[model samples]
Target chain A: MICLSLFLSFLQIGLFSFGGGYAAMPLIQEQVVTLHGWLSMETFADLVTISEMTPGPIAVNAATFVGTQTAGFAGAVAATLGCVLPSCLFVTLLAFIYTRCRSLPILQQTLASLRPAVVSMIAKAGLTILISAFFLDGTASLIRENISVRMIVWFAAALFLLRKKKWNPILVMALCGICEAAFCAV
Target chain B: MEIFQKKQRLPVLLRLFTSTLYLSAFTFGGGYVIVTLLKNTFVDKYHWISEEEMLDLTAIAQSAPGAVAVNGAAAVGCRIAGIPGVLASVLGAVIPPMAILSLVSLCYTVFCSNPWISAALNGMKAGVGAVITSVVWDMSSRIVRSKDPANTLILILSFCLCWFGGVNVICIILAAAAFGVLRSLHAKKGGSAA
Candidate 1:
């Protein structure tokens, strides 16, 4: 039953995640954290961390990690399969039509419209996770005392490197970890 | 000719599988990264696909509802070897992440407990937030650049609905798509009348 739920939840995520991986983050958060209670907000943030560190789309990685966490290897397989099913099914059909007609204006318009919405979803997910990282508590409190200055500093540095220096995200992630570990050791 | 094509099919499928596997395994930061890798390998290296077709495939991949990386691969796969090709390519794309995440999940408890690891994750979590903010910034700016009032309106309204209003994202997306379709229809009618 757990495996079935994992599969179905991911199937919904896969079906609706139109923009790309990052755009799908909120939907994943909604399913795993809010709807299912499969993972807490903090663990969901950790899942994003691991997904970023790893070498795949966030949706697939999330499915595998959450599935494994909840129901072991079989669950991972089920969830991963669910996640990819939409891609396999729809892409093939679209590919066929695309090769025949060479254009899809309606599809194009829908995608154009979707771009802003996707950005909105991504922004919300980022803010939600950002709050969890900074506050370390639930989203209820908006107190200044809840903020973590170290995290804020690291976030600024990371954003600077990412935007100005064009540093690879994996490299930035690794640097963040090493620097944090070193700071803690001292 | 049919016999020759049949003989060539298995090797092409095998190559597709292995190439996508390597691409998916090595490309970090996902999405566009893997798509670029796919272009390099398929268009430039193997010469299995042409550049123009790849762009169209990318469009279809992007517009369709799924991970761009997987959709792109499946489109390329369909072009190359049809249904069997899709199967091979998707399996290739799926395996690396599944295997890697499964391994990481097994060690997650260990990851949580270790002080160094926990500290690292804390830092990485901040990094993750920064990265997401960057993505949001980049995408929003692109929409704003279009200067289309409707698109801009959609962007602002959707952001407000999702973030402040606590509306479900799925509804926002559907509404946006509907708005887009209606706007296009109106424009087309105006064009025809004019």
Candidate 2:
């Protein structure tokens, strides 16, 4: 029963999570945290953090994490499989259709339209995370007390290192963590 | 699409599995980061998929209903090797997250209670935000550089709606798709007249 529920919830997540991994955040929160009570909010936040620090897609990571926390190794396999089944099915079908229809100008144009919309979605997800990081409780307000100076500094440094210096992103992530830990120690 | 048919099926599938495994295991931020890496590995290094094909595949992957990383791997896999390719790539994409998180879950208490780790995570979050912002900057700049006024307009409008207006992403995607169909129909009508 536990594994079944885990599988079902992740299947819902995999089937309905459109756009990308970040866009699936709310749905995962709903199923795992609110609906099934598989994890508390704090643990969910930790999951997000770990997802960021670790490799692979956030949805897959979430499925595995939640499954393990709720059940065991078998649960992890079930949830992870459920999470990716829709991706394999949908993408394969889309790939088949796309290869068949790619020559059509209409199909080409439609795919073109998706580019801007998708980029905008990425921008929104970035801004949401930025706000969540720099501001308390993810409030968008820029009031004096709401901002974290340390985070802002780190954000600026990261942006410069990434865009200007063209530093390796993984290295940048490690530096950011080390610096933050040092700051907290100080 | 049949480019790999000349090659031995087993080796091709094995390479696909290992390549995606390496990419997924190392990429931390996920989504576009992994996509970018896949482009590097497949398009730039392997020369199996073309530049244009990668873009289209990415579009389909993003537009589909699932995690972009897995979808992308599956899409690329299908394109390269067929259904068997999809199995290999999807397995490669999923294995790392499951294994890593499973290990993390085994030490959940220590991980959660460590203030130092949380502090590091706090910093990493800011860095992640910046990484995402850079990706957005790179992508939108590419759109602008393409000099397509319609696409540029869509970029700005969608960003505003989702960020400020709090519009659901699904609605925006549907609206964009509808707009594309309309534009295509209009062009067809014009073509017929000419």
Q: Which candidate is the best by TM-score?
A: 2
- Evaluated on CA atoms against the true complex, candidate 2 attains a DockQ of 0.59
Q: What is the C-alpha RMSD, rounded to one decimal, of candidate 1? A: 7.3
Among these predictions, the greatest lDDT belongs to 2
Question: What would the per-residue lDDT of candidate 2 be over residues A1-186, giving only the tens digit for each residue?
Answer: 999989999999999988776788999999999998999999899898778767788889998998888788888888998989998898899899988898899988887777788778767767776887899767978788888988999999998998899886657766888899999888
For each candidate, the alpha-carbon lDDT, in order, equals 0.78, 0.83
True contacts kept of each: 0.73, 0.80
- Candidate 2 CAPRI category: medium
For residues B39-145, write the lDDT of model 1, one tens digit per residue.
65787678887655665576567677889888888989988888898999998998998888888887865655678866776676677677767766766786788
**What lDDT does model 2 reach?**
0.83
Candidate 1: clashing pairs of residues: none
Model 1, span A18-49: residue lDDT tens: 87777899999999999999999999998997
Mind sharing the TM-score for model 1?
0.63
lDDT of 2 by residue, B43-73 (tens): 7678999755776787778778889889989
